[model samples]
Target: MQQLLLQMLDGTVTSLKVFVLTLIFSLPLGFIVAKGRMSRNFLLRGIVNLYIQIMRGTPLILQLIFVYFAPYYVIGFSYDRFTAVIVAFVLNYSAYFAEIYRSGLQSIEKGQYEACKVLGFSKTHTFFFIILPQVVKRILPSLGNEVVTLVKDTALAQTIGVSELFRVAQNAASRMFSTMPIFVAGVFYFIMNYIVSKMFDFFEKKLSYYR
Candidate 1:
């Protein structure tokens, strides 16, 4: 029993690692993509929008396979499966986050920008101080949803053989020829998602002042 618990802990750690890395990379990358999609330059905005569409349109599993295998076929290079999984996850979530951000930014009243300008604020200052706070408040709920989705999406890493929770459980089940670990992994996923949802709910309540 202790040994089984230990193995489960190892699987939990793998899932946690993927989740952490995806958030670390995806959040900031998503912000950047959001800015590009909203760029003043028509060409840049169009390009970023198109890229976001492509990412949003594809299944994550397909993206994982492409990221893991495309380099080897096209450039005679191969990335580590873990690296590929993280990269693909980052790109996938960035598209979703970009849309979240764009919607938040758009939801703000036009007068806010004018007010900032009237206060002699630069565009950068206006965005950093005036615009971002409201945007953050507006999108926290949606962003929370995406983050929860991401926790579940970590299971997709198994497609690329990354040994995340589901992959680890699958391997253990194959060895033991039993479904116990698979069910155990499912429980872990549920617990993680529950924790994330609760955390987001807390943040949402804290930010209720803005609402």
Candidate 2:
């Protein structure tokens, strides 16, 4: 029983690691991709859109397998399971976030940009000062959804031997020949997602003045 508790704790830590790593990497990459998709350069925009489509179209489990194992099979290099999980997750979620950012940016009125230009603001200044807040406000709900999904998606990391929550639960269930640990894992996920939803709700309300 004590061993089960320890394993569960370890699994929870791993899940948290994956979640944090994915968010850290994906958020900035998503912004870059969103900008690329919005670029006036035809080639850049096409390339960004193509990348987003491929990531979004595929299953994350497949992507995790490819990231974690295919490298060794193809090129004789192996990555740690945690690293592979983080990379796959960041890439997959970044694509979705890129679309969210694109939608938010597009929702802004063109007149705002023109006004910024007329005020003699540089592109960078205009984007940072004038456009970013509105884009962030618009995308907060979508971002919250992605965060909630990420809580569940972390379970996919177990397929690559990362020993996250679901994997730990599976081991526990097999040992006990019961499903209690599985239910416990579900509770962990539910609580994590609930906390994320509340945090986002608070932020959304704080940003309501922008509405």
Best-performing candidate as measured by lDDT:
2
TM-score of 1: 0.94
RMSD of each: 1.4, 1.2
Clash list (residue pairs), candidate 2:
none
Give the range of the ten consecutive residues with the poorest summed lDDT in model 1.
Answer: 1-10
lDDT per residue for candidate 1 within 8-38, as digits (tens), equals: 7887887788889989988889989998998
Error of 2 at 138 (Å): 0.7
- lDDT of each residue in 62-161, candidate 2, tens digit only: 9999888888999999867788889999999999999999999999999999999899999999998899999989999999999999989999998888
lDDT of candidates 1 onward, in order: 0.88, 0.91
**Candidate 1, position 121, lDDT:** 97
